[model samples]
Target chain A: MEPFIRLTAVAAPLLTPNINTDVLIRVEPMIKVPKGKLGPYCFEAWRYLPDRSENPDFILNKPAYRSAKILLAGLNFGCGSSREPAVWALADMGFRCIIAPGFGDIFFNNCFQSGMLPIVMPVETVEKLAKLAQSQGDLAPDFTVDLERQVIVTPSGEDIAFRIDALKRRALLDGLDDIGVTLAAKAKIDAFQANDLAQRPWIYRY
Target chain B: MAASTLFEKIWTSHVISDLGDGFALLHVDRHILHDLNAMKSLVELRERGYAVRNPELTIATPDHGVSTLPGRNIDTVPEGAALLRGYLEETRRAGIRSFDMNEDGQGIVHVIGPELGLTQPGTLFVCGDSHTCTHGGLGALGFGTGRSEVIHVLATQSIYQKKPKQMRINFNGTPGKGVTAKDLILYLIGQIGADGGNGHAVEYAGSAINAMSVEGRLTICNLSIEFGAKVGMIGPDDTAYDYLHGRRFSPAGANWDRAIAHWKTLPTDAGAKFDREIDVNVANVGPQITWGTSPQHVISVNDVVPDPATAGDAARRDAMNGALDYMGLTPGQPIAGTPIDWVFIGSCTNSRISDLREAGAIARGRKVKPGVSAWVVPGSQQVKQQAEAEGLHEVFKQAGFEWREPGCSMCLAANGELMPRGQRSVSTTNRNFEGRQGPGARTHLASPSMAAAAAIEGAITDVRKMMV
Candidate 1:
């Protein structure tokens, strides 16, 4: 996991809400491909035609947005499926930030583990960002997502506030995944397990 | 102290450390893994040099990425062999208990955990698959995790987490004829929309829930992730206890008594406050069929397709229009007569023995419509054998429905069992997300009996009309 304090990059607009994990990373059965090799398959069903040619209409396929590092999306982004490849694909595509009205519960949690910033902004703020991206059309616009400040700075100099808990904020700044956090609490966890084993021995009988 | 919701009660007892800001280090009582997605996490763990903290607490099976064909080996499908071999190798290396293909206990992760008694009341469980919430039918705090979190759990036997707010959905009336727990959940998702349960753990309650069988409860809780909830549960009761009494992994003798005593206290306290509440009357919730892309786009089987112009907002209208365009349906058309090219009767959602019996009853003496493909993939090896022993397989076979071995077959289309492009299907699976069943596949999510009813008539037929 990489530390994500701040990122200023082109933001691709995918206005459709409920953009699910299956769309984010199409599941290919029998393909033993690793997660790092999944970027090309991100949104494969939607991003490409049956002939294996890129769908010219998809925003990510356009020349200006091809290198987008931020994704500005609509409500309920990353819904459906617990596949972490959805997060992996976005990170592999160099997207460090995802701004949306909200995100699916598991997807939101998965982002922190991968050091991707999933920012939840007000619907009005998201709509505003969407409008900005749309107005730019094929020309991708740059946005600044500052995790330290907990704000998204639009291209037009507006600072939109977003809320993230102090714990997640620290995790992002420190590039700490869940394992790192758990390892840090090693003493406490060991103590709890010792106490729990004494109290509930049957649970460990497996 | 205030009365605690069922979620808070279960969550509080598992907290190992309070990280503040609502986050905690929560212990996981059980962790489940499957062949399709577990290898990546295992590889990462190996790279990190972390041995599993307690291999005894974890279980692995080949479910999501294996062929469900009878006598199917990894070579049955191009990728099937490698996926199965990987599962066997990784589980062997990690020392975690695994049920390989053709094994006695091999099944969908969600189905096997409860059937084997690994999912008990008041404990927290996590799995790589989203439908793990099915365990919550027994009052466990079961939910899905991504590959990275799976690695963390294998390493520490716990997960870093923030507690979710709680939601309680109570259904008061008895279901009418032909309605099942699948219908109840589809109706709820349609009522609340796909994102309505976001950020909350939902506990199903009221009279309607209490009357349901454990299998039905599992069906309802299985779709919790479809509506954005991470955890969905039903408080354990005598029904749940009866279901778990003699399962292979269940406690015996005095241990059983102690387990029962603890589980009896797992329900929500009286006057408990939930972050949100919704109440619906199930008497009017007839069989539900999703008419559009998302599960929220569902309507009663007897209702007409919705017009995009009638949507609440522009975004919703666009969503409806896109769905209509993709699904090839017309506004104000009756959903009952909408043609379906395929009917699928299995998934973690509705693939238990009772679910199979319902489908079998409908398929008996009825021929499948010409050019319509119908298939029944049982949820587990146990379900498959039981259905076969009971002659349910013959009923389906006689009715022109293909009876396949259990796993997540048509539900994901990851194995070679996808519906043809532009073909609309009435499926017993959870999500109907575009291309969910396969590329260009149009799916209408429904109950098992409803799917069978469609198979017999070649279109989306009202299951109530077929009911005797």
Candidate 2:
């Protein structure tokens, strides 16, 4: 999981701004009990009406979004409660990259840790991309995010740059988290601990 | 250089090591627990056949899943009650101090912790519940944690974590009449858009914060997490010391002298740098309400629901439209005059004695409106007892509001009680999310007095008129 690393070919873009974790996955789908069955319920509630009728109005119900892995959304895409279930539901639903202008802090952290990429583009750009994808009909809409370049290459061959923290980007590229990074430096930490414990006897017990 | 605000003093005392990249391994002094999240860890421990290593460092209470309706044993619901009972049973088995159902000490963990002195200044507090930041109102460093961290804290009494950067939020200008700590927080959350405090500990200073009583400060600090803040604190002054002087666990005599002297040194230094700082002009704040699924979707009572075209960003605009659609609210209507079917005044957020007194003051002689049901629930047993002694319950009953026992009643509909579907309520609780108060039960966040005024008018009414 390199920061902004991972390039994939996408079909028509799906745009939904501020899609709460709730929409990413319904509560029932995540009820993540029964061990690991988190994927199928991604849009359970939205897909069906109260009478279990198929909801034709839902985004996933549309042909374009059904296979669109590249979600181009507006600003503050995930600004709400810190429910990690939303992220799990999104990842399980086959969305790898959520391109938006902003996201809630907790939701953002959850996205990175779960191997999902949240690419933030300005509002003007997201609006342009969304309208283009919406009107393109059968046109193949896609973008490539080169972690090495920190740039998103649109289907029109235009490159859009984004910003990411250097260290987090490194960790994502290396498939590492805070704990993973810490463990990588275990030997150094161990040696430092041995020396520090002798100097500050009360601080180190384990 | 050592201190300029109560926040700096607490941070310095707890800073074990400054790990690189804006993180610290601060010492944790107290860890609190409740039913919903502890179950996750209990399930794991039961699978591995592990025992808790330290019980003295932990505390448990059953507030989230219990029925607030009196005389109904929690066992009525086999699974939910069993899970709650299991939490209490395990806490007892582990020799952890528990404020369980049928125990006088039983109450919301945040409420009782302060009253009983389990929460104190310059200590770190962690809980499985996000609102645990409510403890920070007492000048302690409190935050919520995940299940894995819960296990770590139970096993070693200390969990590994890096510290967050600090922020100072100054509430300048005077809070207009009827503005409260609850309203201040709701307005602040609205301004920050729910995630503005990400990766930071916010400390409130300025005239408005200084004017708030200890209890008022507690209410303001409790909702820090709603804005993604890890900690929210206010400087400990005479007001703080006065609140803690003789609590059940507060240091005695000689130790008290030492503690007070140390507490006096709590405050941010004049030149200390913060990761971020926000200044809210309290003068502009007014009666606030939640119009959407998040606390950030708030506006002053006089303001109208925002049209998507006028929203700050496309995402925000879309969210506003979605919120309006789900809430059945018109875009340009005044929030102040919206009709309400119920008024709820309780929850970990604003269910203290002061909260009740304010509500009771509004309900003193007025009866609830026809077709409207209102509730006046204190946050803890002690709060209830204090309110009862002051005859606040009589005022509520006289005003046609239900006087319920202490429990997390109606805050979440986990208890058998609920607001009927499609009924709108003015609630003093923290959340207005879909079904947070009850399934399809609309909730608008407001101060206790405002809740009382709504109970009387059966609509969202301004409390300034009702204020004595």
Candidate 3:
């Protein structure tokens, strides 16, 4: 969409694994869309996202290091519940890259659709990347992920090989997502809908 | 040949088209929304100037952010309160039936549907909440949805979905004295692992299911998502009909007769086939809790967590080690008496009036431990009101518990009440994954009575003795 969504940044270490979408983003925040407003609430809110007028201490506001485009996470990231707002929050917040050892079944799909590259690596690789990112803020711990090479290169010239499903790899490389996939089958879908409705009039009356 | 199961009958019956690759254009009959997802759909409606295709088909309620602390009816939580108020105003303006906290008609969306008899046999019920499957206890097809699908349903009253395969989970034999429906479902999760139902719609049947009460069936179906099912159901029966007999929105005198007649024929045929069938012995299940992240990483309170070396599968061992490290629990240690600092017994999953009553029975004359902080919250203002009328509030308050108003409190701490970072809690809510309660808060999922007993003991303890 943006000529290739590449997020070069210092890694923000998120040690927690199996983070549900609700934790990474939030349902209450996604519902209050005034248009592309989720970037602020990506990790915000201890309670519900406070009224835009009221200031609240959100999780993303902690004083350690802020505004990370690259998130280095522990194994089994984005697990537990299947709330999708987490993906929206991260993508909307300009975080286009996430490196983790594993992802939940549903959250993984949700992330791919939003153009967030969820790179799978060994747990030790993620741990090493997290350590590199935490120590060097604004140091630009370079992770230039070359799809052709299928490797993410670090600032220190270390190469991290990543794995992605062949189908998902094509979807990402071609930028063909859910909407594109659905629209590609539009003709077939229309004919099927017509025929099925003709056959089952009672079910398709609506 | 594979035989068509009850799920196949209902699912295929509703299909308008096969979109290929397991996707289908099935029809949704009744669409429901809560405060959050409803508003997103409303904005989309105003943008396209689309009038709802069928207003009567949609139901809206303020459950997720509805205030639970009684008398403090004022909006306290910022975004949730204002958003809920906006949902009430807009839905009322649109001529849609909207339930607020003050409405005796209001409660958790799933709790209200069956109680009011709006959830009926052979219907397609969809909401924006995961536990929408709770309605399937009455032979309806119910499940959660995404924001985009919510928008589609809001505009056209129809949404496209993939048809899931069928699975029938049958529990036979008499449950022991301490065993409840929650125990059965938890034990099932432990057996099947988290992704077990990833592509199935489960139908719970057999003798043990027949013995479960309406409330118990709701609890069972409520956790179907934990096993990865798109939906879960129990065929409508006398128990479901009886529970729905005289609620505010239930079918009245004449409609009741018609409803019952229709519900009577909704059961599966003797030869109905399932894509998969699993059997459980109700007698073997006991009070269960998660010692690790995945619900499958569970054990009986009296048993120790299995060592990784003893794990049968590589994935199980990996999950076991991961959960143990995150939860700070060691392998082979007794989970019972693993001291907890807090106990919270309320959520959409188990915050109904019946759950409160069960906890009340357990808490009668028992003082909570001196250091433990515990609270009992109803699912809805109506549940709160009913509990008060039944003197269940006194039962909770007399047991050194805080009787709080109902919204999803501490369930995710989205309401401002937290279990503090790194503290452990015995909760009646679903999921025990890390930071599910707070940044580092540890959660132990349990039945409401078990939660009450843990609150009293300040640790994991068997709930059977407190039953009497």
Give the top-scoring candidate (lDDT).
Answer: 1
Find the 10 residues in a row with the least total lDDT in model 1 chain B: B78-87
Off by over 4 Å in 3: A1-19, A26-82, A93-206, B1-3, B308-322
Q: Write the per-residue lDDT of candidate 1 for residues B1-468, one digit (tens) a residue.
A: 788877888899899988788888898889988987667678779888788888998999888878888888778888677667777888888898998888888888998888888888887899987888888998999999888889999999998888888999998989999999999999999889889999999999999999999999999899998888999999999999999999988877878888898888779999999989999999989899998889898999989999999987777787788889878899999999888899999989999999999999999999999989998988888898899999999999999999888799889888878988899999999988888888889999999999999999999999888889
Off by over 4 Å in 2: A1-35, A38-48, A52-54, A67-83, A91-100, A109-206, B1-9, B12-18, B45-53, B155-165, B303-306
Off by over 4 Å in 1: A29-31, A135-138
DockQ of 3: 0.11
DockQ for the candidates, in order: 0.71, 0.17, 0.11
The CAPRI category of model 1 is: medium
Candidate 3, A46-89: lDDT as tens digits: 32333444233332343333556678775456654546677777
TM-score result, candidate 1: 0.97
| Candidate 1 local Cα displacement, residue B85, angstroms | 0.8
What are the per-residue Cα lDDT tens digits for candidate 2 across B115-164?
A: 88778777678876567778877778787664455665565444445456
Give the better candidate number (1 or 2) by TM-score: 1
